[model samples]
Target: MKITSAQAWWVQIPIEADKQHVSDFGRLRTFDSAILRLETDDGLVGWGEGKNAAGSAGDYGTLVHLLNTEFGQRLIGRDPADVTYIWEDFYNGVRAGKARKAGHVMPDLARRGLTVAAISAIDIALWDILGKADGKPVWRLLGGAKSDRLRAYASGGWADKDNIGAQLQSYVDTGGFNGVKMRVGAMDGTPHRSAERVIAARNALGPDVELMVDAHGTYTVSDAKRFAYLVRDCDLAWFEEPVTGDDKIGMAEVRAASHMPISAGESEATRFDFRDLIVGRCVDILQPDPACCGGITEAMRIGTLASSFNLRLAPHLWAGAPCFFAGLHVCAASPASFMVEFSLGANPMIHNLSNDPVTVVDGMVAIPQTPGIGLDMNEAVIEKFAKKG
Candidate 1:
């Protein structure tokens, strides 16, 4: 179907004080994102999400403006099935033809940041259109679903030492998730303090449950190593973002210093960044946030990179409906992916915006089999939480 119109909105949902949590990103009181809607000439519509900030809080005005302006009219008259070409065209800018002819990227200087976020949104919407046109799910188009069921981990844990165990166990109890991830690093103040919390959490959960910690790329090499050493016997499933994403060498050093698996790249974009991580041996697991990264197309490419290099794929899904559902399809089709991230926090975008009700039963989730992303946007939710200029 030929594209007719593309539109975007800034959706900001407030989290109650009790539901709010603090980390290096500060108190996450609001969930923010740019949601896109792409309509075809024949009237079929596709939905997508774009995330600019790391965590859940940021002003999405610029992103929404970009999507509604530059990225919006540009999509008109283009085939919705041209997902990869559109992504490359955006990344390469005016040099798209040259890059395609040369079989190499001639990307713009504005390749990262909000540019990719916009591209990610459009790419996802394009895929959604493609899936709907063919009356098949996106996962089916991406080779095929490796499994009908996908395992997911509880993706939120932010309590202190005393309440950490109870908080995580509640995640397990609520969703039957045996594996859960908790926050560490800057939030805990010190490596030692974070280590103590990990110990305390382990003690409460016992030896059977899997524990993972994320620093949000907020650690120094020495501090990350120290914390890894302290948790050596805790049997952590992974140690994520041991150091800043910019410091790939530092991340590699931290990985080498610990037995725990190092995972990162939620703050990154495209396959090139993931290629660097693989080539540099910076991490054991690759975590690409679909909304911040290049949507499903680039995410599957990153998953291919992970598979080719023996690394694991676990996309960061702390996002709105489009990004989370895109992650679900990516995880469903990629062999390198072992689990999906199901947010345990009070995320209004994920829970309220999509008609798809994600049920994590016994730590596993069923992949969506319906056409498109297997869900429809709740227009009422969008209208209710949409931020106005």
Candidate 2:
């Protein structure tokens, strides 16, 4: 189907004070996302999301602005089924024809950041349209799903040493999750402090339930190594983004010193960034946030990179409905994927933004069967949370 129009908006749903959590990103008072809407000439519609902030809260105004103006205008009359070509065109900018002829990427100088984030939304929406047009789920379009369901891990544990146990336990109790991840690093100020809190969480969850820690790339290499050492005996499922992705070598050093698997790339932008991570031996698991990492097209490439290297794929899915559903399809289809992340927070984008928030039962999430990303946009939440710029 040919695209007829495009629109996007910045939605910032405020979090209640009691539900707000402090992190390196500071107190998350709201969950923000840029949502894109694409309408085809044949009456089909698609939705997508782009995320600039790695955590729950950040400004989506500029992302929304980019899509609403330049990118949205450029989308009109394009073939929505030409997902890959459109993605390449967006990436290559002025040299798109040359890149297509050369059969290689001739990307624009502005290949990363907001440019890719905008491309992410466009790419996702295009895939949604393709799925709808083909009368198939995204996973089937990606190459038939391997399982009807995938294991899901509770992805929130932001409590103090005194209450961290209760917080993590509640997640396991609520979803029967076998695995759970907790925040650490900069928010706790010191590696030792973060370690103590993880210890508390582990003691409560016990060895049966797997524990993972996310430093949010906030720790120094040395601090990351220290944190890994302190929690060595905790049987962590993985140590996520122990140090900033900017320091690949330092992250490699942390991996070398750690006793558990290292996971990263929620802050990364394309298959290229993930390529460096895999080659450097920086991590055992790759975590590409579909919203920030060039959408489904690039995320699958990253997943292939993970499989080729004997690594695992566990995409970062702390995002809105479109992004979250996109991740679910990727995980369901990718052979390297062992699990999916379920955000255990009061995230409006994941819940109120759509007709149905994904449900976790006995620590498992079923692959979506509905065509496209399986989201029917909830206009009430949009009206309530949309930020006028």
Candidate 3:
């Protein structure tokens, strides 16, 4: 079957104030998502989610238009099964122009929203098509070794002060979680203050619980150094995104000075960018987001590179329907994957968007065995939330 049309929908989902206040890591106060839908001639449809942040609705809209109007034209009549070829053509074709480059040149941002998000949606759709074509789950198609179950980490530990410790305890009480991650670096706070928070969390979880700290790239080299040293006594699992995404040198410096394992690349887009960071020895762990890092197609390549270097992959995931499944498939197939992130905060989109909602039992997510991504979109939910734009 050939790809016939591509469309994108932007959905605005608001997070509760208490949830938003869980961590002061960044300026984001609301949660939003850009969902992409691809249609084929034979009536098969595939879905993907675009990576967008607060106040970035316009960017997602532009990306959808570019993909549907421009990139979609390129895919029309192309065999939906040729996932890799289509990805390469789109990468080389659309990214060659000045308009694309201009869009990519935003400060402190990776490539433009459209470039990464649009490609990510299409890449996911291609994987879905490939799974359907082969009559197998995406995990098996990606050569997954362990399909039974994959370990997961409790990702959203940013609840209010009184709830943070209890929230972590709840995850452990549920059983099967190998570890948990907590947010840090809010409001230009000093490393000493951040260290106190980490220490408190460690004490609450006790010495056995594997603790991870995500600075959200909000700390400077010096701040990271101080906090890393302080948390070293606490036995942190890893320190994530201590510095900005572009700061390879800073990340390398942090890696050199810190006792904790450094993890990053969530903000990075393509394989080339990750290659540079890997070659530079900038991070001890790689956190490639399937939605932002060119979807499953490029995530596999990144995972392979991380494996060659003996680096760990724990993908960054905090989006809606398609992103969760795409990430789950990659993490299931990737040998180097240490664990995948699961948000504590609820998103109705995640709960109701799929026919088979992704569920975590005893902290382990079961791999979907059905064909394609192993989950079908709930059309009723989509119809209710589909954006007119």
Judging by lDDT, tell me the better candidate of 2 and 3. Answer: 2
lDDT for model 2, on a 0 to 1 scale?
A: 0.90
| TM-scores for every predicted model | 0.98, 0.98, 0.90
Off by over 4 Å in 1: none
Measured on C-alpha atoms, candidate 3 has an lDDT of 0.76
lDDT of 1 by residue, 1-389 (tens): 69999889998888889998888888988888899999998888999989999546568889999999898888899998989899999999999999999999999987899999999999888888899999999999998998988989998888999999999999999999989999999988999999999999999999999999999888899999999999888999999898989999999898887888999989899999999998998999999998989999999999999999988999999888889889999999999999899999888888888776868999998888988887678989888888877
Residue 5 of model 2 has an lDDT of 96
Evaluated at residue 110, the lDDT of candidate 3 is 39
lDDT, model 1, position 4: 92
| Residue 301 Cα positional deviation in candidate 3, in Å, after optimal superposition | 0.2
Candidate 2 accuracy as TM-score: 0.98
Comparison by TM-score, 1 against 3, better one: 1
What TM-score does structure 1 among the candidates reach? Answer: 0.98
| TM-score of candidate 3 on Cα atoms, chains taken together | 0.90
- How would you encode candidate 3's per-residue C-alpha lDDT over 1-389 as one tens digit per residue? 88888777666555556545435534444455667777888877788776744222234566667677877677788898878766665666645354345654222233545677678888997788678777888989888646578888887676544556777878777655759888877543788877777777787888887888888888888888878887788899998899988788998999999778989988888788889889998988888887778899989899999999998888887667788888889888998897878876556556667787577888788877877777688877667765675
Give per-residue CA lDDT, model 2, range 1-389, as digits (tens): 68999999888888889888877888888888998989999999898999898555567788898999899999999999888988999999999999999999999997899999998998888888889898899999999899999999999988999999999999999988999999998989898999999999989988899999999899998888888889888999999998888999999999998779999999999999999999999999999999989999999999999999999999999988989999999998899999999999777678888787578999999888999877777978887878875
